[model samples]
Structure formats: C-alpha cells, structure tokens
Target chain A: MQRAKAEFDATGVQILAISTDNLNGPLAMAARDGLEFPILFTALDPSIPQAYGVFNLFGDGLASASVFLIDKQGEIAWKSIGKNYTHQVFPEEIIEQVKKLN
Target chain B: MGAVFGRKNRVLIAISFVAALLLLTVACGDNLSGPSLTSGQQVGAAPSAEAEQPSSAPTPGAATPAAVAAVGSESKSNTPPATATGAESKPDASAAQATGADSKSDTPPPPIATAVSKSDTSSAVAATETATPTGTPVPAPAAVSETPAPTSLPVLVNTPGPVAMLAPDFTLPSIQGPEYTLSEYRGKQPVLVVFYRAYW
Candidate 1:
C-alpha cells in the first residue's frame, strides 16, 4: 500500500485496508506507521475474516496475517499465508508482482 | 627331527611350484585372449559402419557440387531459402564446410545457408498449415493509449436489512468540521466511508 501510494500518486490506485483488529489497535498501528490510506474496521465481525479465509480460530478470533493481491478483474492473483502474525510479506515484492499484472 | 623339517620344506616347495604354474597360466591366457577379443570387437563394430554406409552414400549424391555451390552463394548473398530437409541437413553441410576449409578446398561450401534454407522452408510450411487461415487480412495490433480511461467506482449494493456493510450510510463528523451524511454526498460524487477506531 505504501509503495502504491508513492509510485502511483496520480495513477488513482487507492488502497483500502480492512482489519478485524480492535478499534484502538488498528488506529494506533495506522498512526504509528503514518498511513495515509483508509483502514476500515469491521466492528469485530467474524464473518468478514471467514469470508476472506483469513480467520484464525484462536484467542480473540482475529484474522490471520495474509497478503492478497486482488487484480483489476476482482480475481485473487496471489496470496501468501504467514504462520505467524509478524511474518508479513514485503511491500516491494507485492508492488513488483502487481506491476506485472498491469 | 631332521626328516620332519626336510619333509616340511619339500611340501612348501611343491606349493610354491603350483602357485607359480597358476600365475604363468593366467599370464599366458591374458596374452593369447586380449588381441583376439579386441579383433572380435573391431569385427562387431564394422557392421555398424556398414549399416551407416547407405545413409552416407545418399548424402554425397544429394549434396552435389551444384547444390553445394548454390548454398555457398546463398550464404554469401544473405538470403537463405526455407526448407525442412534443407534445415535438417544444415549441420552436416556445416561440418563438411569446416572440413573443406581445413583441407583448403578451392570452393568453400555455404554451410549456414543450407541450414537456414531448410529451417525457413519447414517453418513456412508449418505456419501455412497450422496458422489461422482467415480470409481477411490480419489487422495491425491496436496502439496502447497513453492515458487509460477513468474507471467507474464499483456500485455498492445495499442488502435489504439493517446489517452494517463496509461503507454503511451514517452521519459523521467530517475533516472540514461539518457534520456529513452519505446521502448528501451521493448526488455530487462518490463518498468513501472510512470507519476508523480512535487510539488517542
């Protein structure tokens, strides 16, 4: 999202992030990272994560750390499932791979 | 005691003699069989060459002096004819050319031309047979536009219920310090509703 914002400033590629994280957590993370994109909270809805297949059945019923590259056709082009929440994908690789689809 | 020691020595000598005879036999056998086995292998390998004779014999006739000269001129001319058989025989022509050059032949064969001609012919034939035979001439590919057309925002469908969608209609305090409802902004432009949780 950060790379997209930087590289595609006038290209009109808007980044919309959906999070199942609690209000405070998502807000604090966004603020800390200085995110200019819109991060929407699903109001602790379990169905949202289940629908996206990123739902983890553990404590707090939080969504797993997964990166999905949805193409312009609304098709999932690439997806990565990280075992741990901290094992997130690099933004550069995602941007690079997304550029190929374009 | 002396008789027993002498008897033991005699037995040892006999054993030594037998061992020497066995070694001599083995050595003699190797000398006699080695060359004969090699000759037998040569005889076996001769038929393989004989089998290859017909293929090689036809090639020289097929690659006549006139044909070789034509190929040489084609290679020098830089316009190779396309043919499948010509392509297949290119490597042979190339090798022959190389050998001819090494042997200082008066006329060096055009090896590359022969190969290229063959490839071109085969490729042309294959293309003609398999390619889409549309009656109309193929139009040139469309030029890519520098500026892409503006994409319309996806229409958010409202399910008939009170269920909160991603961009639910709500009256919220705007960044410009005015209370805004989604319905008010509906006619003018697309309103992106972002429901954010406050940390501070």
Candidate 2:
C-alpha cells in the first residue's frame, strides 16, 4: 500500500490499516516500510476486528484479510472480503473500487 | 458363586484394559495427524461460514475465543509456523528494516513473520501454485483495474440499511500515538479501512 500512497492521496482517500498483531509489530512495520499512513493496532481492546467482521473469519485464530471503502458519511461504500485468509485485495484493485465511488 | 464372580470380574477387567488401549492408540494417532488435517478442513470450510456473517446483526460482544487465543499466543510463540517459510521473505525484509529503523535490539523478526506467514502463504500459493514463481513480490495489478474488481464482494458485513450502513464506530489507537474514531471521519474524507490478518 505504501507504493500507492500518491495515488490514494490524489483521490482524497485516507488509508487506515488495522493490525491484529500487537502494537510493537505494526509499529516496527510502519517504521521499517516508511509507511506514510497510520497502521493502528487494537491493543486497548482487540474487538475492533471483530466489529469489522474480519476477526477469526479464517478460524485460524486470526483476522481474515479484508478491505472496506467507507464514504465520507462513514457508510461502507464497497468491501472485499478475501476468498481465503490469503486472498488480499491488491492496492490497485482498491484504487479501482475507490474510483467506482466517484 | 465366588468362583463365578471372580471369572466375570477378570473378563470385565481384561475387556476394559483392551478398550483403554485402543482409545489410547486412537488418541495418539489423532494427535499425530490431526493438526494438518483439521487445519486443511478449516481452510476449506471458513469461506462458506464467513460468507453468511454479514447478514446477521453483529453484536460487538459476540467476539470469538479464537481471536482471544490468537492474541494470547502472540507473545508466547517465538517460532514461526512451518508454513511461514514460502511467504516470509518480503515481511522478513520489512522486519529487518523495522529492526534497523527502531534501533531496538530486542525485536526478533521470526515471531511476527510466523504469525503472519501462515495465512499469507495462501496468497503466495494462489499466486505461484498455478503460476510461475517470480522473484517479484505481489505486484499491484493495474491491468486488473478494467476487470470486475479482482476480489469478489462475497460478504457485505455490518451493513443494515437498503443502501450503505454506518460503520460501527471505533476509537482505536494508531501506532503513532493518537486515537482514531471511525465516525469522526464522517463528513471529513473517505476512509479506506483495511483489516490485515497479520502485518508487521
């Protein structure tokens, strides 16, 4: 997603990644990848992913890979839940979904 | 009468011992082979079950034990799952960069890789299992843009209204030390919320 930062910025979409990992893991990741966006961790309460319906979707005791495009009104405009835990929606596909919103 | 009772007791004891031994063997066998088989089955069944989740009215309290278990195991297991190797390369590099960027001596990369690699292998497998194993990592599929979004809208979770449903409000802390409320972004700018199974 770091690769598409410029494109996402061009579209006025704010990218927020919720990491199921502990705080340090994503903190280390963002720092290492020079991630321009915020990578939030649910250390305070791990239910955030469950709220999103991404948690334990794979039953591997982990969140399933998923994406939600929330419009300015906070309603989900489009979403792609991975066919499997490993099936991630690519950044370009995300950009395409965002374009559809406009 | 005493002799008959003794014989019956001996027969019963022998039968019970045999049954116990059989159960022991079965239990041991299951322990030896169950993980891989169960994991495979769960992988196949998960998608079908997950597809139905969005239609139900989700309660924030209906969290699963698996999610809690994942978090509990997060700090304990340092060894990466066996499946991690095929897909650990990219994240391992990023982890190395993380190690350097944070200048912390304690953070080991393997655990993070291990937790994430189990599922990530699916994508890698999806990519290379049918196609050639290129040195390149996951490429942004720009060409795929014209195609009906590469991922299916298999699940429409957390939506209730005829149109779009308001995302459940959340006040999560970013790694950068600020609280982000999902509803706060309402009327501000479109937010793309990506829930990554494991990222580090």
Candidate 3:
C-alpha cells in the first residue's frame, strides 16, 4: 500500500486500512513501519470486516487482503477477494480502477 | 594427556571465535532494508528511467532485484561456512545448510514474521475457507459477534458490488485517535478501503 500512496494521492482517492489489531497494536505497528496512512482498528465488532465480506468467518477475527474501490457516491466501483493472501490485488490495477471512476 | 586435551580445547575455542567473527563480518556488510547498490544498476528503471517515481512503479516490486542480490551474495559469501562445517558434516550438506542459513539470517524480519504467522496461522485458518473454491471444509469459527454474516460474504463477493450503491458506512476509531466515518469521503473523492488481518 505504501508503494501506491502517491498514485492514490494523485487520483484523489482516500486510503483507509482496517485491521483487527487493538489501539496499541496498530499504533506500535504504524510507528515501527513509519506507516503514513490511517490504520483503523476494528477490534470492537469483529464483524465490521464480516460486513465487508473480508473477515474470515471460520477463524479468529482476522481479515483477508480484501480491497474495495469506492466511488464518490460511496458505491463499490471495484473490489477483489482472492484465495492467496500474498497475491494482493495489484496496486496498478487499483490505480486504474480508481482513476476510471474519476 | 591433560596438557594435550587443554591445547585442543583452546584450539576449538579459537576456531569458534574465528567462525563467529566471519559470520558477523558477512552480516554487517549486507543491508536488508535497501536493495544492494549493485542491484541499482541492473534493476529496470532504478538507474534513470523512473527515478523520480521512487515509491510508485519502482520500489514495491523490488522483490525481484532483491532476490537477484540475494542470489549474487549467496554465491559469493557462502564459502566460509562450508569450510567451517566441513570438519563435521559432508561438504555438500554443510554447503547447502550454509546457504540456507545465509539466506535466513541475512533476512531476519521476514523469517521472524513468517515464523510468527506460521505458528499462529490457526487464527486465520490459513485464509482458505470455503464459499470459495478452496479444498478446505473447515467449519466456520463459532460466530462471536452481534454483526450478522453478510449473505454475500463467502461465495458471492466474486461479482462486483453495484456502483453508486450505498457502501457499508463505518465509524471506527483510530488507534488512540479520533473516529472516522467512511461515508465522509463520499461526495468528495474516491475512497479505497483496505481491510487487512493484522499489523503484526
């Protein structure tokens, strides 16, 4: 995600990363990795991710690498959920998707 | 007999010290954070073409050139351990193990992360849950929250959700910071929401 930060900024798309980590958890992570983007913690309702169809319902409340490109109208313009955790939706393709919405 | 044994012990200690120092030297020379300068030239666009866009097109996909540097360094610095371990194990096995250790040790953070994730992967069920085309028949974990499972969560997200449809607006708090509303970004610009497992 850091790699695509500039493209996101250029295209006027907001990037919000949600995770199951608690407050201190993501704080420590952000400081350690120098993460510039906002990392929202979803520890309270574990189902926030569930609603998005990214939460692993079968395991502890953990999220998959699910990405959604939301247009200005708040609708999902493009989204992807895959079997491979490491094989993330390519940033280039995301940039293309978001750019298309503009 | 005592004198001979003492001398051998001293020799063994010295050998251990030399080997440890050699290993430290090898480690101190390799920088794991940035790509090797040697790779700077060979990596496409790193030299000149897209230097201005360091983070965009060039940096994220650096795994390739980093792998190249790893290969180059492995071939060169992998000799010492083979020689050291040759005193015990066969040269071939020790050499292989030596290269493996070289690769593992030089890359510390990733190994630690993988070790951690591997150990606690049950928290994620390895992410190959059903409703998808994976082989696992792993039963869904006992649902523990008030949030109801979306009908489209498991098998149905394959189709893109409609455009201009109201997304699930969220009002989640940041780590020790103010709360954010997902819908706030609407009517202004595009918003890309990224949902990941954990920061760890």
Best by DockQ: 2
DockQ of 2: 0.32
Give the number of the best model, judged by lDDT: 2
Lowest summed lDDT window (length 10), candidate 1 chain B: B140-149
Ranking 1 against 2 by DockQ, winner: 2
lDDT of 1 by residue, A22-88 (tens): 7677666766777765665566776645554456633547776655544443444555544554665
Q: Model 2: per-residue lDDT, tens digit, B1-200?
A: 12222333334433332332222223222323333222223333333323432233142211112222222232232122212212423333332333334222212333233332322332222222223333123222211221222121112222232455677777777888787878888898989988775552
Error of 3 at B196 (Å): 0.8
Ordered by TM-score, highest first, the candidates read 2, 3, 1
Question: Across residues B82-116, which tens digit of lDDT does each residue of candidate 1 receive?
Answer: 11112333423333333333222211222223332
* Model 3 chain B poorest ten-residue lDDT run: B138-147
Chain A superposition TM-score per model: 0.80, 0.88, 0.83
lDDT of all the models against the reference?
0.37, 0.50, 0.50
After superposing candidate 2 on the true structure, give the runs of residues whose Cα lies further than 4 Å from its correct spot.
B1-161
TM-score of 2: 0.46
What does candidate 3's lDDT look like per residue over B124-148, in tens digits?
2312121232312221221211012
Positional deviation of B79 in candidate 3, in angstroms?
72
In model 2, state the lDDT of residue A34: 86
- Which regions of candidate 1 are displaced past 4 Å? A1-4, A8-12, A57-60, B1-200
lDDT of 3: 0.50
